[model samples]
Target: MRKLLKILSREWFLAGMLLAVAIASAAPNLGRSGGLLHIDELSDWGIFTIFFLHGIGLSTEKLKQGFSRWPVHLIVQTFTFVLFPLLFIALDALIGRHLPPDLRLGFCYLCVLPSTVSSSVAMTSIARGNVAAAIFNATLSTLLGVVATPLLVRLLLGSSGAGISLGATMLNIATMLLLPFVIGQLLRPVFGKWFAHFKSTTNAIDRGVILLLVFGAFSNSVADGLWTRHGPGLIAMTLIGATVILAIVLGLTRTAAKLCGFSPEDEIATVFCGSKKTLASGVPMAKLLFGAHPALGVIVLPIMFYHQIQLFVCSILAQRYAARS
Candidate 1:
């Protein structure tokens, strides 16, 4: 209890996340879509701002340096698209009879999600890890997910040629994330020094955006009956399942990083990038993959659980890495 208190006081960001979840649960109608604050647009801009700052903070040379780390890239992608999905499939095979069909599909969706772009890079940056490499792998994962996620769904979920016509989604990604990043890269020579000098300020903004995202997610979860309707037993099952999967993935990534003889920085990147699955990408893709399935909300329930769990766990892990540095 004392240790938990010490951590809460020390890592206020994580504490803030808890508070955000509490607030969202208490007033689900307030922060959710069509609510008063209308967090969707705010969250969209927040994402844009974070990536733009990432651009300014990253040096061109560092980008060049990390671009060709093919081994690191390969490992991160393989763990994301291959190992994670395989483990989920294996679990489904083992105990799928006990799992609800909706919940089973939800977990499978969580498994195949791309590594989240913002949080993956955010956590890596917070950990004082290889931010450049993180940016590369995360961005690549998201872009590739447009194809890979659906293809995997067809192969694993046994769908027949369900193509996601995400021309608009791709555009949104470019405008919200990639375009700002490119602009930041272009303006780096001018504001790079300013960003470096006030690095803590940018870090604070990133953390704030993370909190906003947490609030929005929890708010949506509540409005969608993630807690109120799911009942305690199923909620407990989701939490436990997500926890077990996260732990196994974290352990596997850490072990793989060490075996590859990666530097501490690369190891940090590997563990974070490999362990993450992007909820931002997952939710929309879920709709496309299983459209009008009356139980779509239930099918996405596992994603909600995993997203919250990963952020909480990684925040602690990142802080520990920061302390070590």
Candidate 2:
């Protein structure tokens, strides 16, 4: 009990909780006559609410300091937006032919999403690295994901003849991404001070919102019978894929940072922040890009797996970095 309590107090545990919520949400709908809480509406609101809190908690001055180190910022941004997608494309060319088309497309989509805000910042901070840099990169990445993710999908996935609905995707982005971001920016002035003061309370709000989103998405999956589409082999394949990808990205970022002669602080920030993808970004994008099809639950399977794996791995990495520092 004591060990479990200690483990649960970690940031990765919070992320695992979010994943459990997502899995639980889908589990109920797997049964034909299940009576589950259909919390899709709540999830929608939760996303926006989480974004609102994120915006309010942001310190623009801190972000600016991070960005002022322009070379480091550029490296992280390029890794996130450019290099990562290219790697996914190469992977597609190599082995994607053997995978399900939807899964391949989902892999591509996951590659192009943004770095996470909270965990990235937390991990970098724990590593005694550039917390401000993590904050800036993550926030900017999420903001840019509104446009970049859609455009990337249209470019890469569209080339494979599974053309994404650009107009619909944009519209969803406007509603989900822009609307909340704008609201958050507008309300930042009013609640920013309070948000700063009650950081722990606001963190709780973030977790709660994410939990609701997980439940809602999973519940939809259960209702739609997403589980039967998978077999034992596919599950094993997914775990392997996730593990390999996480290892590659983490190693790539670290190697690149070391080659560039980054300070330990900046290297820690670069490696951790650059290697992550945001589930918060992925879930909404899944709904936006693939909402027309019921089968997308299966498509998002890789991303869900990757999300939890990254969190668990990075949590351990962050602690190691902290201990070393």
lDDT of each: 0.78, 0.75
- Count clashes in each candidate, considering only residues at least 3 apart in sequence or on different chains: 0, 7
Q: How does model 2 fare in lDDT?
A: 0.75
Q: Write the per-residue lDDT of candidate 1 for residues 1-325, one digit (tens) a residue.
A: 9999998877787678678878987897777766888865687778778778867776677656678877889999999999988998899888877976667777877888889877888899999999889888987887677667766766676642244334554555567666777899899998888779888888788778757765765676677776766667777778888999999999999999999999989999999999999766565555445543445556666777788789989999999999993
Quality of model 1 by C-alpha lDDT: 0.78
Residue 155 lDDT in candidate 1: 67
Question: Number of the top candidate by TM-score?
Answer: 2
Which regions of candidate 2 deviate over 4 angstroms?
1-38, 159-163
The alpha-carbon deviation from the true structure for residue 295 of candidate 1, after best TM-score superposition, in angstroms, is: 9.1
What residue pairs clash in candidate 2, if any at all?
25-218, 25-219, 26-218, 26-219, 29-222, 29-223, 30-222
lDDT winner among the candidates? 1
User: How well is each residue in 22-54 modelled by candidate 2, as lDDT tens digits?
Assistant: 565446553122235545545567677777677
Give model 1's TM-score versus the native structure: 0.71
